[model samples]
Every structure is written in C-alpha cells, then in structure tokens.
Target: MLEVLNNDWKRLLEEKMYLCVSIALTICSIVAAIVLTNTMQTKGNIAMVVTDQSANTSLSKKFSSSPYFHVSKMKKAPLESDMVQNRYDAIVTMKEDGSYNIKTIKSDDMKKMIVGALNNPDSYVPSNDKDREIGTNIMGYMMMFVLIQGLFYARFFAKDKEEHIIKRVVTSPIAFRKYLFGHATFILGMIFAPTFAVILIAKILGVAIGFSLLTYALLIAVLSILATAFALFLNSFFCVADTANMIGTATITLTTILAGSFYSFTKKESVLDKLVHLLPQKDFINYVNALEKGHLSRNIELQFIYVLVISAIFFLIAVMKTKRDYVYR
Candidate 1:
C-alpha cells in the first residue's frame, strides 16, 4: 500500500492536469471568499432615507456612532419607485405617532444592523428577523460552494476509470486496496492545501473565517475521502466512461441539492430533510454552523468520525465489487 501510494503520489505530481486543477480551484476559492467578504462588509454600511427630516438628526447621530451601522441621510421621503431604483440599503419613514417604518431594499445586513440599533433593550425598538434570516441564507450559499466543489472532484474518479488508467493500475503489482487508498490520499491532501489557502486569504482580508483549524482540517479531510470513495463506487458499477460520468454528475448534483447546496433545505420541514441529514455534506454544514455559533462540541467530533467511517464502508464495498468483477472476467 505504501509503495502504491508513493507511486500514485509521484504520478499525480507529474500530471499537469492535477496541478492545473488544484491551482484553478485555489484561485476560485480565493475569489469567492473575497467577493463574499466584500458583499458582507458593504452590507454593513446602512443608507437610510428619512421621511421626516426632523427624525433624521437623532437617528443619524445614533446610527453613525454604531460600528455596525453607517448612517446616510436622503434629501426627501423616498418613493417606493425610488427605493427600488436607488442603491440605498434601507428606507426609514417616521409616522405621526413617532414610530418608524423601515424598508430594506438592498442588503439585509444593513437592515439588521439598523433594526438592532433601533431596538436595543436600552431603547424601545422592534427586532427584525428578516435580516437575520438573510444572513443565514448568505451562509447557506457558502456551504453550497463546498458541496459543488466536492461533486466536481468526485467526477474525476469516474474519468480516470473511463480512461482505462484505473484498470491498468489494477493489473499492476499494486493491490487494489492500495490503489484506492492512494487515490483517496491524493484527493484528501489536495483538498486541504487549497482549503487552508482560502482560509488564510480570508483571514488576511479581515473576514471572520471563524472555525478552528483542526476541526476544519478534519472536516475537509473526511469530505475529500467520502467524495473519492463514492466516485470509485460509481466507477466500479458503471461499464462505460460516459455512463459513469453521467451517473457521477447526477449523483453529486442530486446529493448537493438535497444537502441544501443552493438553499437551506431545513427551511422546509419534510422527509427530504430527514433523508438529507444522512449525507456527509449535511453533517459538515451542521458542524460549520455550530462553529460559527461558537458551540463546538464532542458531537461535531463524532460527526467527523462518522464521515470517515462512511467513506471506509463505501470504499470497502467498491473494492469487493471490483475484485469480484476482475476475478470472474
């Protein structure tokens, strides 16, 4: 196994495609992190159009003092049409009763900061759950990226089999187990370097890419292993490269969709949610959410272990099937 792994490592290093893909993925991750961080920071800057100029003085003063809120005053009462047309993050209108009607038009982050500032228990203010939900949705998008990338890498295994490279390797003195292990190891190592690079870039940019390095590393390692295992299983079962490719793509797409890659699947309570809970990415996202909330626990550690176990089980099944097919054929 060690020999096979060494050979595979050497082969992988020699492959230009592997290096190109790694560099491309790293660049994509960095770009995404930058875009998200900028969007979030810009959203923190609140632009309020006050209906009553009189109300603007106190609110502007109060909001300007807040680190979360950047208060900008509009010249007049902003029309609904204007709100839609303008870049103002939110529009505030004062009523005769001294209450305010706030309309968030651009970014929810701005809305939340304004609402939180206004509704401080020290001050009589109403809470805005809408912005909170929007923040959660933004986070959901990032999680989706992870799932999409996982699926992208998974398809590579199918491609390898279709190219007859995996079959050729199986005929080599290298045990099938070692070949599989090497494949998984290569992917796991490749994923971590890029993951850490993105995290480090985010930190440098002052984005709160907040997660314990150890936990994040473990989560990514397990995810990479799971992706490789599933890809191998697909490769073993499918006869043609085209069929493997289609099935691999479909499987990853469906799994990601079910895992809340594009949106929060948990928002809708259903059997689908329960089913998605069994997926590795779902557990990973849960752990990330816990980390964001500063609630890391033994349960997260157990989940990481669970992912690794699942990967091993899938790999084992793939090996057995591959071996049987080789023997019979």
Candidate 2:
C-alpha cells in the first residue's frame, strides 16, 4: 500500500492534476463567494414601499425595525408594475383595519420571511449571520468542486486499465486491494487539497466560515472520502479514460443540479424534494446550514453516519467491481 501510494503520488505530480484543479477551483470559489454575497444582500433585504401613513405608526415602525426589510414611506400609490420590474422587492399597503397587503416578486422563502416580520416585528431579529452565509456559499461551491474533480481523478483508474498497468500490478506481489486502496487514498488527498485551499483563501479574503476549524476539517475529510468513493464507483463502469470522463462528467452535472447545489427548490411537492434525500450533496449543504444555526451536535452525528454509510457502500461496490474486472483478469 505504501509503495502504491508513493507511485500514485508520483503519477499525480507528473500529471499536475491537483495543482491545476486546486488553483482553478480556488479562484472559482472566491468569485462565487463574492457573487453570492452581493446576490444574497439583494434577495435577503426585502425593500418595502409603504403608501399609507395613517394606518399605524407603531406597525410601520415595527416593519422598519425588522432586519429583513428596508421600509420607506411612499408619497404616491404603490404600483405592481414597478414591483414586477423588481424596482421594489415588495409593496405593503395599509388597510383601514391596520392590516397589511403584500405584493412581491420574491420566492416562497423570501415571501415567508416578509410575512413573518410583519406578524411580529418586535420579536423579529434580522439575521446578521455572516459566518453562516459565507459558510454555505463556500460549502456549496466546494461540494460542486469536489464532484467535478472526482470526475477528472477517476480518469487515473481508466487510464491505468487502458495502459495495462492494472494487468502488470496483478502479476506482481502487491495485493490488488492494497492497490485500489492506495488509489482511493490518493483521490481523497487530491480532493481535500482544494477544500483546504478554499478555506484558507476564504479566511484570507475575510469571509467568515461560521464553524470552528476542527469542525470544518472533519466535514471536509468526510466529504472528500465520499467524493473519492463516488468517483471510484463511477469509474468502475468504464475501462476507457475518455468514456469515463464523458459519462461521469455528465452524470455528476445533472445530479448536482437536481440535488440543489446551485438553485434551491422551494416548493414542497416538487420532484426534487423526493429525489434530494438520495443525494449526498443535499445532506452536505443541509449540514452546513445546520452548523450555521449552532445545531451541530445532532447534525454532526447524522451527517457523519449518513456520509460514512454511503461512502462505505459505494467503496465496497467499487472494490467488488475491481475484483471482478481487474483482479480475476
């Protein structure tokens, strides 16, 4: 296993796969963080145009007090056309009974947030959790980066097969299981490199990661193992490097989207809700969100158990496939 690890390390250096991908993804993660920060500010701050002053002074004051809204008194009538154009996030009209009517182009989450603030403005505290926001943004892109890197790393297995290196290894004294484990370790190391790099880069850029360093390290380690196992399972289907690259890339891309890595699915009855339970990416992001809320104790156990179980399952399958395809051959 040590020998195999050394050989894999040398090969990885020869290819410079880790260096290339890590630098590329580090830049991407930084850019993604900046973009998300700006976007979330717009999406999070509900701009309100209040047209009725006589409705309730205290209620209007409460609305403005809530951190979720930016309330301003409008001298003129509120127009739905302007709201549709996104000039304003929402318009709150005062009724005679001191109630309010809201119109906004925001999504369900944003709408719920607005409604919640209006109901109890005094009890509402605007979330200033920059750590959580930055953490989620970084983790989201980090998971996507790991998945894409896995696709490329899987090529090593396929390339070895095509080059008859697997055949040569089989005839040697080294056990095939050790060889496979060595390669899997290499993949995990490669994936982890970029994850750590992103964290460092984020810290240097003054992005708050929310969680303690220990927690972040553990999360990254588990996720990297899961990604490595997933890539191994995916690569087991093809002996040709190019074929694995094409199919694996396409498969991960679709799965990432469906798993809500980019845009979240807000509706409860949507098809994505049913399928998201089966995806690691969904659980990974959920764990990050939970961490932001300081709910890490129970969620840590859950995420660890879930990720480990899934990683073990995929790894076992990959091992079985390797034995059938390469060991016996």
lDDT of the candidates, in the order given: 0.58, 0.71
Top-TM-score structure, candidate number: 2
* Clashes found in each candidate (C-alpha, N, C closer than 3 A): 1, 0
Name the weakest run of 10 consecutive residues (lDDT summed) in model 1.
129-138
* Residue range 12-97, candidate 1, lDDT tens digits: 55666745665565556545554664464333434554545444556554654555545566546556665454445566654434
Q: What are the C-alpha RMSDs, in order, of all predicted structures?
A: 7.1, 5.6
Query: On residues 251-289, what C-alpha lDDT tens digit does candidate 2 reach at each position?
Result: 777777666565564345556575675777777777777
Q: How close to the true structure is residue 79 of candidate 1, measured as C-alpha lDDT?
A: 63
194, model 2: CA deviation in Å?
3.7
Best by lDDT: 2
Model 1: runs farther than 4 Å from truth?
1-18, 37-171, 204-207, 296-305, 327-329
Candidate 2: Cα lDDT at 147 = 72
Residue 66, model 2, lDDT: 60
| Least accurate 10 contiguous residues by lDDT in model 2 | 41-50
